[model samples]
Target: MRSSRARALEATINRLLAGGPKFFVKDHRAVSASGDPLRYPARTQRLDYEAEVAVVIGKGGRDIKSDDFTSHVWGYTLFNDWSVRDNVSFGPDFAYSKNFDTSATIGPWIVVNEGIDPQDIPIECRVNGELRQSGNTHSMVHSFAALGEHLSRDTTLWPGDLIASGTPKGTAVDSSRQETDGSFPDTLFVKPGDVVEVSSTLIGTIRNEVVKPTG
Candidate 1:
């Protein structure tokens, strides 16, 4: 749980926080194909995978109550919010670091069922068949209902809009940096020829292969 990069980010956020929490919107261009090859950016030194669950909206509404979250949900699916670690710096440029084409991977398909519980499902990430990250929704710091209500407070969540739940802690950087010195493991980060898969019992799996950018 104690990551040098995370600690550095925490320190940076603390200095910028005047009072409460903050959220930033990402451009739609960041989305990528779920089964397509992940093109490694020529400029980044590190491309990391963040295994997460994605919630798809079924209806459009504002100021939606937490209890009404279920009615608004369309389904659940897998997502990998890829990160370019080297592109990050003090006071981070999230847009520049995370908005690359094919950066946000989603799907395999959506599971639309009212009986599904988002709070206790198992989630994991594997690189080349080796488990890299593992955790359950029960450990999520924020509940899906709370997130839905908070997001709809000032903005409308339309049908088809995807809301990605935050990722669990076993990222490539986290494992390498926490277990060894603060250095990143060359084998951990996604590089050309690597296959990354994010899976969950509730939704299924999303697999992608890393490849050099042809353009």
Candidate 2:
């Protein structure tokens, strides 16, 4: 998504010769309760939390037009697109790294889209109560309507299908972060016992505690 830094943004824009927003498939199994434990992946080297705004699909259609994207929207909510920073390149490893259990969180609740401006909502992420990510939807390279238009180019959108648009600038992956001698080793990444909270006034907070697996 264009919500990241220059380095990341350039890559995404260049990924497609047409300069469209990048999109990827997430693990459906990874979705869990807002207050559920973020089970630490056994092999993850850089566990990160990505604060995002997810729009709920109320209407279903195929090849939805850009101008008609709003009719399909039922409401809005918060989503944490928890990511594993190892083997970021798309390939076989990409699946295991991001598809782990409890890797994503939906929301505490949903706020219907009546007077809400989905294009300019504030979003934030906190690790152990410390602010990590702070940004708004205005910076997105692609709007929610555009995403819906492209995503439904040839696919069918169904009711209740949440469209997690994209994340804001500040994430563990962001290079602007000046944390701990400038490194990702263990400073920016979340570890066991860390309480990760992604919140927005439009919806609510989804707090998940990172925990080591017992199995």
Taking the tens digit of each residue's C-alpha lDDT, what string does model 1 give over 75-178? 98888988888736635587677678788898889988757888877899999999988988776656788788888988899998887777787887656544
User: What digit string (tens of lDDT, one per residue) describes model 2 on residues 63-156?
Assistant: 9988989889999989898888865766666656667898769988888845888798889999999998888888777889988998998899
- TM-score to native of every candidate shown: 0.85, 0.87
Q: Count the backbone clashes (under 3 Å) in each candidate.
A: 0, 0
List candidate 2 segments past 4 Å from native.
1-18, 176-184
In candidate 1, which residue pairs get closer than 3 Å at backbone N, Cα or C atoms, i.e. clash? Answer: none
Shift in Å, residue 188, candidate 2: 1.1
RMSD of each: 3.6, 4.0
User: What lDDT does each candidate get?
Assistant: 0.81, 0.82
Candidate 2 lDDT: 0.82
lDDT of 1 at 210: 92
Candidate 1 clash figure, as a count: 0
Top model by TM-score, which number?
2
